[model samples]
Target: MTTRAGDRSDGTTVWATPAWRERATAWADDELAAQGVRRTGAVEQPHLRPWSTVLRLPTSAGSVWLKAPGPGLASEVGLYPVLARWAPEHVLVPYAVDAERRWLLLPDGGEVLGRRLTPEAADRWHLALAGYARLQQRVSRAADLLVAAGAPDHRPQRLTALLEEVADDAAAVTVTDEEREVVARARRERGRVEELAGVLADDGTPPTVQHDDLHRDNVFAHGPRVFDWGDAVVAHPYASLLVALRDTAAPYGVGLEDPRVLAARDAYLAPYGGPTAATLRVVEAARTVGILSRTASWLRALAPLPPHEAADVREAPYRWLAMLADGESL
Candidate 1:
């Protein structure tokens, strides 16, 4: 079961229901007609993304994927052309976009990588990492353009400021005892986090585009196309690995120290240069900062939840903050 409609971090209460279907129907119809598709109905893809609504519309030729950004967010339509200029093959460029309504239509990119990850997993992950590295390098030159297109400024320099702001918000909200504890723990470790953030910023690392959420499912298996640019950022390129390294490792029953995992990480870093112990140090701190930013964003989402829905939403983030702040390795 999914989080109740009222508990969703995104403000929209309309999702996976008739209401959401009705609103998206018009967009689907328009895009289908433009694509010369002679279909009368569309189906909602059974996906659990909390950020947007995706509809799979069948056509005489192929399927068309239509997406509408969730409540109070900018449309990612602008990002396609920017990515195309640098890494066209790695992203699915939309055919038509309605900027005002936060809607876009894209050609179906076939199955997601997660479905077939168990076989040739190493090779697939290496391909993904290498392609992603190229995307980062090319996009670095266009950082300003990407940021204007809705990517957040996720550089390490901004982490502490964002943390403090979220901490204060949590302290002021009085929403739940659980959330307050997360904020309390964050505040307790604020000094150490700030110092590390400074080092990350001072490393003089060439900042590049980061796909903040690069979980396997967001990638296509064969084409190795990347989807879901909603969490894209402009940060040190290695920061991408900090997030991906931890994400891809644990699920496969491998630790960060595992040689196999470290090899793939080396592959990701290969685009920039050979692996070095210094880069490893920055990445170690970056992982914590990334988690801190994510936890703060979650708390922001949790701010509006009612008392009844608060408990279910607050536990994991709270526990993570406590563990990370207390110097426990995740």
Candidate 2:
């Protein structure tokens, strides 16, 4: 039970600080002694961008990824066990080297899927999405089990609350007239999409688990293995599809209308009960609202400003606000 530098009151260890590193090393040594696992030593890997810190630990069993959670640690921990049970076939299972320490060991077998998603890589994308679809089916089944256990349904409501907060701040944020228009439209569209949740839930459609945060970075594809399961949620099945579409559009340079995009979406949904065209549209709209709200906050905090980048950080909230107000989808 050796403690690390960034060890919180709850005993979760933060791997970023020197004290935590010492503690982590000590804990690893102890765990190895208990489990008969041989340690190779700590290998420093470059940290991933966009926040949080991760390190690669070399061990005799295999390489393990040590991720330090920021504010969302508890939420991620709560979600992982559920995903492990529900989507065991599709996700990488996290081995808890130290639960109290918040030290996670994941098999380092997968390559990032984004790297393989080239225009010529249509088949790979299709395979990836198909696997994703199967994962969603399991998630839906898990959601039902959670509901039966009286777990609070937080997915739909969280997005709704975030949008409302964005709307409240939209009026005060300064932005160009064009960006204002975008924000206004987004606000209105968000309202319309929010209203459809009840309809979607009540229409006798089975709920599937969703990876609410399904960015390209979250997915890794090595040979046939996909990793990272921290953000899985039991909610709308199409949520991941929307994430794929959104991510593919920008950094991946894949357009929404691209044949591969459409094909991948279809392949992902084909095995599960297929969602109607309208349902897909609603999911896409809902996801856009969520993204805009997040982007607004990020822009405000990071200050991605004028003279560089497409739009100013200060303007993002307004643009999203205007888009929502006008009922437009990104």
What is the C-alpha lDDT profile of model 1 across 145-189, one tens digit per residue? 877876667677777776676567556654567667767877877
TM-score of 1: 0.83
lDDT at position 85, candidate 1: 74
lDDT of 1: 0.68
Model 2 Cα shift for residue 166 (angstroms):
5.2
For every model shown, what is its TM-score relative to the native structure?
A: 0.83, 0.71
Compute the lDDT of residue 295 as modeled in candidate 1: 55
> How does candidate 2 score on lDDT?
0.54
Candidate 2, residues 51-133, lDDT tens digits: the string is 24567777888776666543323335455566667776666776654445445555575566664546655566667677777
lDDT of 1 at 195: 82
